[model samples]
Each structure stands twice: as C-alpha cells, then as structure tokens.
Target: MAFLRPLGDTGLTISALGLGTVKIGRDQGVKYPDAFTIPDDQAVRELLALARELDINLIDTAPAYGRSEERLGQLLTGRQDWVIVSKVGEEFENGKSRFDFTPEHTIASVERSLRRLNTDYLDCVLIHSDGNDLEVLRQGTLEALAELKRKGLIRAIGVSTKTVEGGLETLRRADVAMVTYNLAHDQERPVIDYAAEHGKGILIKKAFASGHLQAGHADPVQASLDRILGTAGVGAVIAGTVNPKHLRENVEKARRAVGDL
Candidate 1:
C-alpha cells in the first residue's frame, strides 16, 4: 500500500482508502434499515488492527454511529500514527435521529467525541450538513472550529456537502470538504475539480451508493470513481464495508485507481 495522500497544501495527509467505522460496531443494514445487526466488539477491533497492518491510517466515524468511535478507540489504543476523522451534527433519540448544529451542541459533540474516541486531538472534524444552504452555516460553529484548531484540539476543519455547488462554496472558504460522489450519485464534479485545482482535499462519501454498486453494478462504480479522480481536487475516497473481503476489494480498487494515476 502507498503511504498517504496530502489533503491540501496545509500539510495534512492520510491514507487514500480510509476505514469508515460506522458499520464496524454500530448496526448493520443501516443503509437498508429493515435489516440491521451490530457487529461484535472483538471483531470490530480485529478489523481495525487489520486495517492498520495494511497501513490504512485514516478511520472515519461520526457521533451518531452508536458505539463506533468507542470501538475504534478501544482498538487503536496507543496508536498515535493513525489519523482519526469524525463529524458532528445529528443526534440519536427514541430510535430515531435528529440534527443539531448550534454552536453549543457542536462543541458538546466534540467533547463527547473526544471522550468516546479516547483521543486528545482529532485529525479532522467535518461539519455535518443536513443538505442545507450557507445561510444555516453558523458563524459560531466556524468560530468554534477555529478556536479548536487554535487550541490544537482539531488539526483541520471541513464541511460535508451534498451538492457540487455547496462543496465548491465550502472549498472557497473551508479547509476541506466531503462530498457525495460515486456511480449512484455523481453530482459534484465541478466542485471537486475546483477543489483539486485550488489545492483543497476532497473526501468522497457514498462511493458505492448504499450497496447498489455491490449488487453487481460495477460499471457505475468504476466510471464514477474514474471520473471523480480524473477531476482536479479529490484527495481521498471513504468507502465503508462491514465484510473484510469486501473491504479488501475496495482497497484493491483504490490501489488500482492510484496505480493508473
């Protein structure tokens, strides 16, 4: 495997293929809610160890992902070389989820994330967007992130946007941006191109489009990823998998893409 890829000119670099721990300890079949089963903690730990052995450094998780952060923390104890990235927004309640990004809630979420991840500082913290416009992008939240960065609580900050326009707008202002792209929902080319051109790291989510590609629909996956990587600003792609074999398959795909590059 390769070492790591720089997210931007800001000296931040991570593995090209990150492990999304949402399904590691939390409920499975989350993408298809009717069928859900959480994995054993020990299995999740072994998975983390395996990823590290493979030299995969970045582990992406979210507070809403039940015990994912905690599981990763347990698995990654004493491993400081790994880059842990997490997001804040969306809370779980009554077997449902709610979104909240007020300044106070964001800070609280970070605190909880720190405790859960058992980490002193997060490598990156992305603002979880609810598909909202910039009007809801809080100045206080940005200020809080700036404060965290200043205090060394977070190494960098970013936003999770669902549209190319929003991603571009975030790239224009934020240090990094996570956008949805893949064979299933490839709609952020312009923003990704701009990010690549301007030295912004573009993290891709939903590469498989919630199991659609895994169901023998590989063309869209290949074509979409090819198109995104061909664009300017893409930094790394985060594709989640609960199955180890499938995870390795995703890693192979990433390696092939990078090799072609």
Candidate 2:
C-alpha cells in the first residue's frame, strides 16, 4: 500500500503520493512536455476509483485548474475519506492566469472554493504564489487564511513557494509548504529539511519535472519518487496523471519508495 503520513500538526494524514487534478480541468496554457486530449467524465470517475483502490487519499486541485474543483465535487463519492488540497492567489479565466493575495480576495476565494467543491470546508488551502512569495505573505494573505481556519473553514494553511526565502517564510508563518523538488531542480531541499525539523507539512510539485523527464530514462518515475519521498520532510508528492495504469505505477513506486525508507 502507499504510505500515509501526517500533515505536520494539522491532524490530517495524507498519502505519500497525491493525484493532481490539473489535467482533468484545464488543458490551455499548460507547460506540459507534450499535448494530450482531456479524458471524458466516465474516464475521470474510473481514475478516482482507481486512486481510492490504490490507497491514495490526497487530491490536489485549485481554482486555477479550470473546472477541477467542480468535477471533483461531482465525481468523488466518499467525500469524508479523502484529503483535498486547493489553492488561492491564482485564478484562471478565459485561458489566462491572474493572481491576487489581498485579504479580501483570500477570504472570498476560500468561500468560492467551498461552493465549487461542494464541501463545507477545505482540508488544506495554499497561497498560489505568483513568484512574489514574500510580498504575498506580508500582504495579510496568510492572516486571512488563518482567519478562515479559525472559522473552521480550513484545516491547514500554507503557500506554494517559488524561492528559498519564500519557502523559509512559509515555514515560519504557515502550517505547510508546497515546493518544487526533483532531480533536475533541488534548490528547495533546505526548505524540506526545515519542515522536517519543525514538523510542518511539505508537499512536492513538479516531481517529474512536468513529465519532461518521462522519456530518455530507464525508470524516471521510480527514480523521482525514490529521491523525493526518501527526503525527510515530504508529506506528499502531487503527481497529475489521468491514466489509470500510470496512476497505479506511480502509487506502486511510492510504496516502494516508502518501503525502502
């Protein structure tokens, strides 16, 4: 089985590998290595079922990921059994991306996410950093998220940081941190270490470098999981694959990675 780990002191446990929902919603303006057709509704339902059968409990989504949140709300059967992680600060509209981190936007975004996701509250909410991490943290965004948590609208709060300083600040101020750490780019390992030492949750993004490393390697998926999950602070790695076979493969790799640890 895929290992389940605690999301710091947030009182939530997440699978070591999460199913990312970006491809299920949006296919425009994406940086994927290759273009692919989006799957239909039945296909998505099967994928979610497969994820549950494989012991995957975390589903990563955001308002920026087109219609992902709504789709999850419609397709997911056992809402109480899974941990849903969404983001604020970024919104996708008409094939374009925009960011807002003000307190007003932060609170309003969480409320909208609740409505779209068909949930009373969110398991985790992150600041979708627009490469200005420090400024966002200082602009009462995290404070607003904290307020939501106080109101029982969110369980944990954090930022998807882009820089080392931002990751450090996230650790200082938030309950978790989403960072990019993989073989090609490991500049955020220090942030992982800090999270480990401090008992803060760490979620990995771009673990396979947006699928650019899929080709030209003997077993890139396993290699990537071994490296990232073997790290101390990582609570989960968000891997978005609509293919059921690939999803199982990733979960198998995650099991192996944790077993090796």
Q: Which candidate is the best by TM-score?
A: 2
TM-score of each: 0.89, 0.97
Clashing pairs in 1: 195-233, 196-232, 196-233
Error of 1 at 169 (Å): 2.3
* lDDT of candidates 1 onward, in order: 0.74, 0.92
Model 2 is weakest, by summed lDDT over 10 consecutive residues, at 212-221
Model 1 accuracy (lDDT, Cα): 0.74
lDDT of 2 by residue, 1-261 (tens): 239989887899999999999999999999897887788999999999999998999999999999999898888889898999999999999999999999999999999999988999899999999998888888999999999999999999999999999999999988999999987899989999999999999999999999877555579888888889889888999999998888988988899999933
How does residue 79 of candidate 2 score in lDDT?
89
Which tens-of-lDDT digit does each residue in 192-248 have in candidate 1? 778768888788887767656644444565655565555556777887766677677
What local lDDT does model 2 show for residue 137?
Answer: 85
Model 1 TM-score, 2 decimals: 0.89
- As a whole number from 0 to 100, the lDDT of residue 229 in candidate 2 is 89
